[model samples]
Target: MTPRELIDVADVPGGPPLRLFRRGGDFMIVLERNELMSTRMHGSEVALGTMACDRLAGRPAAHLLIGGYGMGFTLRAVLGRLGADARVTVVELVPGIIAWARGPMAAVTDGCLDDPRVTVEMGDVAATIGRATATFDAILLDVDNGPDGLTRPANNGLYGNQGLADARKALRPGGVLAVWSASSDPAFARQLQRAGFAVETVRVRARENGKGAMHVIWFATKR
Candidate 1:
């Protein structure tokens, strides 16, 4: 077996963490002793973001909230697809994720954070959403492993019934909320419906190579 090569490093809250590294030609982002994300699996994230934005294609001055800043793939894709008048608020739980993007994974982002329309919030995405008014045009949640909550234990509540209710109240009338999951959760879809969102599920290809797990994205619209 061939070992992955180290390319660059980043700083987390506790210590100096590996940020970017190239194994052959692929780049990966390491966070807190874990490879948080890699370029090899970026397509699925971008696809989820794009599908969410697609539901709002004709809207002007749309306000979007993105949960998670892993490698900035979701942010970059939304920025590219949105109109100039659209505003994006990205809420990341870890400040180190932003540092990794600015320092090591800068190329992937293409300076999207510097855009005047983009606001970077260094905090938990759920807390950010809780404080906001019902002013968002769309909400994209890519945090954790999905409704199962793999990355952070506390993240489980984000997909719970109450969490879904909060997200519904945070969106404007007819607003869209999209969630990316590693797999399907039938209970989650039921919760979305209970919160008054018309829901739809999409299956996406795992990687740019077009082979891997079949990821699910749940698109819900406020009623």
Candidate 2:
């Protein structure tokens, strides 16, 4: 097998630099030796969007806020589940990831950024949630690995007490806040429940063919 070639690198706030690699026709973004997201395994990423958007399908206008834009899989999937009147606000912290989306991974993005219902913001996902008040029908969080903050120590706040409260405050009544995790965290689930959400834990397959490792997604609906 041929070795993966490193394409570029970018520094991330409160974390190490992100490394981009290419192998054959696929791409991967990694932190140190740990692979973050890949072009190959995307089933769970798509599920992250579908699970959140499906719950918001019946809502009018369907204002959605996506915390991260990893390869644009979740963003694209959410757009597919939403209607013409729906609006998706994607906040990607890393500017290089956005550049990579339009450059090396343009095919993976598939013009989701160009959609009329989409608005892109380059800033901290946490900051966006902090200021928003009952503004979103669904908030899809696919940043870091989960509540533990594998990518950045600051990411832990997204699953922390004040952070969870902020996320809840940003959601409308009956709105859903979905979080993607590489593994299960019982404590995180409990946090969601304590934050006034009806928690539903879902175990999803990582690969599209249902053959890879299982991942966890928590759907926390505002009460």
Candidate 3:
């Protein structure tokens, strides 16, 4: 069995650094010692985009904000499901991750970064949500594991009461906020409701073919 080799690292502010490793043809991103994402396991990530995009399917004015560009799986999935007129703004805190997508992970990304409907921003996604004023139709976040599972101290605010409020403000009326998580958190769901969002929790397979661990995705609609 071939062992994973450390290929690159991205230094994050107020958080653990991101480590990139490659083994054979597969790649994985980790924070500290815990794996953040893997090229081989992307089912939940794909669903994060597709499910959110599906909610805004008929809307011609669809504009999406995707937080965290891990492996570009969610970005690519959302792009394929959205219309040409739709716009996707992806915010990634670690610039190196984006570079890795274009460099080592090009095959998986499929050049989605350079697509006409997409915009890439190297910054904090939490800040981006706060800056927007009813700007997006859907805001998807797959960062820092989940609300309860915080890999970084800085990411805590994103799942906090104020952060959820900011996300609510960023979305247009009836806009959706989708968050991908490794596991379900009842408290997080309650927090979403407290922030005036109509929330629905869905349990999905880790693999697209329904063959892996059950992952959680929250669908919170701005009310």
Model 3 misplacement above 4 A: none
Measured on C-alpha atoms, candidate 1 has an lDDT of: 0.80
lDDT of 1 by residue, 1-223 (tens): 5578776554443234445677776677764565556888877898877888899867899899999888778888888898899999998876766776786667876898999999998877778777767879999998766785556667777888878878888898899999988778888898889889999988887785778778889999999
Residue-level lDDT tens digits of model 3 in 11-122: 8776778898999999999988788889878899999999998887578969999998889899999998988999999999888888898888889789999999999998
Give the winner by TM-score: 2
Pairs clashing in candidate 2? none
Candidate 2 Cα misplacement greater than 4 A, ranges: none
Worst 10 residues of 2 by lDDT: 51-60
Model 2 misses residue 87 by how many Å? 0.6
List the global CA lDDT of all models. 0.80, 0.92, 0.89
Measured by TM-score, how close is model 3 to the native structure? 0.97
Higher-TM-score candidate among 1 and 2? 2
lDDT of 2: 0.92
State candidate 2's TM-score: 0.98
Which stretch of 10 consecutive residues in model 1 shows the poorest summed lDDT? 9-18
User: Best lDDT goes to which candidate?
Assistant: 2
Model 3 error, position 103 (Å): 1.2
- Give a tens-digit lDDT track for model 2, residues 102-189: 9988888899999999999998999999999999999999988877778888888888889989999999999999999999999889
| Superposition error at 184 for model 3 (Å) | 0.8
